[model samples]
Target: MSTPTSPGEGAPTDALGRALRLVSFAMLGGVVAIAAVAVFTVGDEAGSGVDAFGAILVSVVFVAAALFVPRRLVRPWPATAAPNEVKAAGQLRSAAFLSLVFAELPTLIGLVNSFARGVWLPVAIGALFSVAGLLLTAPTADRLREWLARMESAGARTGL
Candidate 1:
């Protein structure tokens, strides 16, 4: 298995890995910031039971998106480019960004619920899911390389 590499920590050939690491960390930071705000401001009591229900619904949707969107976004392109090609880098970056966004959605929704309904449960749930999902699905250098390898293999098998 390839060891995970941080931004600028790998050889020159690992530029894509470095870039992906930076992007992933930045996205994770944003999610964490939103969660922090929700967690810190948990005393508002303006939310109705209906708002709580809506929060539940949103949380479910966010979980579903987090589970499925990354796989879909990382699907191999039709091009026959090599795994190390520039096209692969673009695909990897796009996949990482989209995945991070999906992972962060629950936290964003939770923050909004906190502000709009002042409900604590929804905000708490959203914060939990956001932090957990972001940590669990964080993009690493190894993951980027693995994805590229899978894409390259798929393209070759399909004769793209």
Candidate 2:
């Protein structure tokens, strides 16, 4: 009875943007708090242990936050795509989707690098991996927006 929608953009920007921002700050605070706790609790005496703790703790929180918010926000977030936009689950004939996958590359690299050094030597590897995983999913919503905008413009020019 209703139209199909884009995944993350369903929430209108002007309205949902504030809520989204609020949620974002809250989530960020949560991760930072996790890091702060890890740092303060794990001082120089046991620097590696605490560093490991902070990293893993923050990493897990990031992953959990990413997964949880989308589901929670799904209801209230209306699809904000313009009519010509490429909705989620639509055909992926182009390379637009690659942006999302690669967007978190920087963060992932840092995490992985930390992990590589830590793996055999046993450092904050858990946290590094956790952060890397979190980074992996970071770009979806933005990538969707970018892809849709590209699609719309291209379609407009081609009269698609």
Candidate 3:
């Protein structure tokens, strides 16, 4: 709930910004590592039968959830909360965690499929989704400020 800072105003030096960036990078790193392992171990032939079907089904579910869930989970700032950096930080942290978890889900599913069935497609698709999500939603200072500003504007319009 802190007053939204202008772009390039050095918000990253704040504690909340540092924590958000650290967590965002950690999640991205995990996805990259998993994807790399899966890619490096590719073998002959894709998976078949029930194993293949299950992998496909699970992958679909994970990808769908990844695409849809994070936005819903990142609720707006609470009205009763003090308007301060701590509140802003808490909101940013929550949003970042939700985004990262869903984004990483597909990659995890892909890794499992790759390890169990030796198929590369799922892993590759997962890597693409993971990287895209991480890049698009990574909680930098500017992004956080933008999101908070939007939420604040919405709250104002709704009379919250």
Candidate 4:
């Protein structure tokens, strides 16, 4: 027999999804704000060639790190630790925020370069990389469900 869920039963999950989306938008907003500030302060000025190749290379490395580091941080629970879905869910939330921070690095670097060299190219490159990272890492309801299911199975196995 199955139990009927209340109307507000899924509110937490829905709220989580909304919160993650909000965070994603906030990161994008940061990029926009940086761009606006750069434009207003620098005023269409082309900077004296601040090593375009180097900036692009650094951006690529940071983007790659942003994509890779989160998986390491979200590792499975150790055998000694009792499995708790609530804890797993909290870990997921923490990991998501950390991932966003890593993803935002490119944009922050671009902002620094923009301010130092007074060029827009660095900011644009950084924004592109960060946007891709942010979009790729944004958590969805389906992903949350899958993660919970996986964690439950792992708990079952360990609890046996």
Best candidate, TM-score-wise?
4
**For all the candidates, what are their Cα RMSDs to the real structure?**
4.9, 11.8, 4.5, 4.6
Per-model TM-score versus the true fold: 0.70, 0.32, 0.68, 0.75
Give per-residue lDDT, candidate 2, residue 145: 44
Residue 158 displacement in candidate 4 (angstroms): 12
lDDT of 1 by residue, 1-160 (tens): 1223465565332666666667767776776676666666766564677766776678677766765676676665555633354565566677777766777787777777787665566676766676666666667655666666566554442121
Find the number of clashing residue pairs for candidate 2. Answer: 8
Query: Per model, how many backbone clashes are there?
Result: 0, 8, 1, 0
Poorest stretch of ten by lDDT in candidate 3: 151-160
lDDT of 3 by residue, 1-160 (tens): 3443655554432566678678878888888887776777787555656554565566566556654565565456545544455555566577767776776777787777777777766776776777777766666666666556655653532121
Q: In candidate 3, how many Å is residue 127 off?
A: 1.1
Minimal lDDT window, size 10, model 4 = 151-160
Q: For model 4, what is the alpha-carbon lDDT of residue 32?
A: 72
- Against the unseen true structure, what C-alpha lDDT does each candidate score? 0.64, 0.37, 0.64, 0.65
Ranking by TM-score: 4, 1, 3, 2
Candidate 4, residues 1-160, lDDT tens digits: the string is 0111355556345666678779878887887787667656754765545546655777788767766776666554454666464676576677677778877888788778877786777777777778887777767665544444454443442221
> Which ranges of candidate 3 are over 4 A from the true structure?
1-4, 7-9, 12-14, 46-68, 74-81, 154-160
Output the number of the lDDT-best candidate: 4
Q: Which stretches of candidate 4 lie over 4 Å from their true place?
A: 1-12, 47-50, 78-86, 149-153, 156-160
**Which window of 10 residues has the lowest lDDT sum in candidate 1?**
151-160
TM-score of 3: 0.68
Model 2, which residues run further than 4 Å from truth?
1-12, 46-148, 156-160
